[model samples]
Target chain A: EAGVVQSPRYKIIEKKQPVAFWCNPISGHNTLYWYRQNLGQGPELLIRYENEEAVDDSQLPKDRFSAERLKGVDSTLKIQPAELGDSAVYLCASKGNTEAFFGQGTRLTVV
Target chain B: DQQVKQNSPSLSVQEGRISILNCDYTNSMFDYFLWYKKYPAEGPTFLISISSIKDKNEDGRFTVFLNKSAKHLSLHIVPSQPGDSAVYFCAAGKSSGDKLTFGTGTRLAVRP
Candidate 1:
């Protein structure tokens, strides 16, 4: 089966602009997650979804970051008025009864 | 506070030798643990996992050992190969919550 898929493997945006990343999880997976990884650091959870419901998004920056999984099969993470600090790799993953599978991720750079 | 930590930022080992990576966690509630391998410019891939009930789990040449008393976990790669060179991250979670807390990660370089 195909692994999780993410679009726009790389993106560059100006500060104060808006940027969005998309993800398509593996088939039949019931859980999806969004994470951010900075240089020399591990990936950090930003949001999680069980089906269409966002179960945990406490770490998400509500002021500028938002995410949604309408049908639960795919998801999108958006950042408005993006700042240079927002530059990082945005990863999306899906999980079933076993381990979670991650996508190639979208590398976003804010200039 | 960071619950999971990988103290070593990087490690180097010869291809025919063994490579050991260590991780420590402060959360006793975490019942499931996993190791992930990541290459530059790509997402992390699941390597191995161990449950709280078992002290050890082995798959092929990779083995994961968990010590509940010490709240420590280690991943061992026997006869390490150059292909094994990558950043390894340790993650912990509870079976009920389905949320994983990840460590800072350790970069391993296997010399050929």
Candidate 2:
């Protein structure tokens, strides 16, 4: 089976511009997650979805960052007025019963 | 606070030798642990996993050991190969929670 898929392997935008990343989970997977990884750091959870409901998103920055998984298959994470600190890798992953699979991720750069 | 930590930032070992990576976590509530391997410009792939109920789990040449009393977990690669050169991340998750907390990761280099 195919692994999780993410769009736009790389992205660059102005510091105050808006940016979005998309992800398609594996077939029949009910769990999806969005994480951000900084240089020399591990991936941190930003949001998690069980089906179409967001079960855990306490780590997400509510002010400018938002995410949705309306169909329970694909997901999108958005950052409005992106900040310089937002430059990092955004990874999406999906899990079925045991292990979770991840996508190549989108490297976002804010200048 | 950082709940999970990989103290060693990098490790180097000769091919056919054993490579051991350590991880320490503070959350006693975490019941499941996993190890992931990542190459450059790619996402992480699952390597091995261990549940809190078991002290060790083995798969092929990779083994994961968990010590609940010490709150420590380890990944061991026996007869390490050059293809094993990659960044390894240790992650922990609770059975009740949906999120998984990960350690900073250790970069391992297996010399041929």
Candidate 3:
């Protein structure tokens, strides 16, 4: 079975520009998560989805960050008017019975 | 506040020796813990996990020890190999399927 898949392994955009990242969870996995990892730090949860519903998203920056999981399979995370501090690796993961598998992640560089 | 923390930013061990990475969590509600290994430009891969009910869980070369009372956990790799060099992250959650809180990773360098 294929693991979680994320598009755009790397992305570079100027500050104040809009950028989007995409993810496709593993088959039959009902739980999906989006995390951002800054340099020298661990991945922080941005949002989580259980089936098509976003069950947890308190950590998400509502002002500029938005995420959606359609049909509970694929997800998209968007950042509008990006800032230099937004540069980081965006990781997507899906949970099985116990373990959560991660994708290669999309590295975003805001210049 | 960071719930999970790995104090050691990096560690070096000679090949064929043992490598121990430590982690501590502030959340008492976290009942399950896991360790993940990552390489450059790659996502973390699940290494091993242990439940609150058990104090120790051992795989072939990796072992995870959980101390529920102290809220501390550790990962031990025996006879470390050069290929084992990578960043290791410790994570905790309410349960195995719950959302995880991760600690700043510890980069381990196994010198052969």
Candidate 4:
């Protein structure tokens, strides 16, 4: 009955550096999602995966952002040449398509 | 392009009083609505949810009221406490299993 888990709860990187965040969804949950939360803003969906298939990623910045959930249970989100504007919290969530549970999130600060 | 909106950037409520937070959505296709509460350095936690079919749903001290016709929904916290101070986000889910669209959060400050 563990909740969704994410790694590197906090990260600080320089502008134009590459950064990656990881997530492990709850056991038996088929739906996984990654979201970005800027200061004073709600979490925005970057990508959503249903058992290794990316069902939605329209919000992801394809030019520098890429995600994968090939194994389905765990997923990774990466941003290349990160910009200062990318400084925000990356939250990982899992659901049964019924209820969502979020992880502690990886807070990235790009200077 | 922001479909879900929480116009109130923040709210200050005295403890032990009712704390009401409001949200509005433009998309009529959104059938499921949810509320999430988050503290600093943490992810959002589900507070309550309501379906389009129901006008209200209640759990303990938290209640969610939906007005589909007006495209408005609200969360009422009775006897608010200091612990209730956090950012609350309202999200809408489409009927076709599409991803949720969330509003800019509203920060609630309950003064003791």
Provide backbone clash counts, one per model: 0, 0, 0, 0
Q: What C-alpha lDDT do the candidate models reach, one value each?
A: 0.95, 0.94, 0.95, 0.92
Worst 10 residues of 3 chain B by lDDT: B91-100
lDDT of 4 by residue, B1-112 (tens): 8899999999999999999999999999899999999988789999999999999999988999999999999999998999999999999998634677889989999999
Residue-level lDDT tens digits of model 1 in A1-111: 999999999999999999999999999999999999999888899999999999999999999999999987889999998999999999999998899999999999999
Q: What is the DockQ of each candidate?
A: 0.73, 0.74, 0.85, 0.74
* Predicted candidate 4 versus true structure: per-residue lDDT over A66-97, tens digit per residue: 99987778999999999999999999999985
Per-candidate TM-score against the hidden true structure: 0.98, 0.98, 0.98, 0.97
lDDT string, candidate 2, A61-92, tens digits: 99999999987889999999899999999999
lDDT of 3 by residue, B6-99 (tens): 9999999999999999999999999889999999999999999998999999999999999888999999999899999999999998975678
lDDT (10s digit) by residue, model 3, range A1-111 = 888899999999999999999999999999999999999999999999999899999999999999999888899999998999999999999996878999999999999
- Model 4, position A95, has a per-residue lDDT of 90
Which regions of candidate 4 fall more than 4 Å away from where they truly are?
Answer: none
- Best prediction by DockQ: 3
For residues B28-111, write the lDDT of model 1, one tens digit per residue.
999999999999999999999999999999999999999999999999999899999999999999884487899999999999
Give the C-alpha miss distance for residue B75 in model 1, angstroms.
Answer: 0.4
Tell the DockQ for candidate 3.
0.85
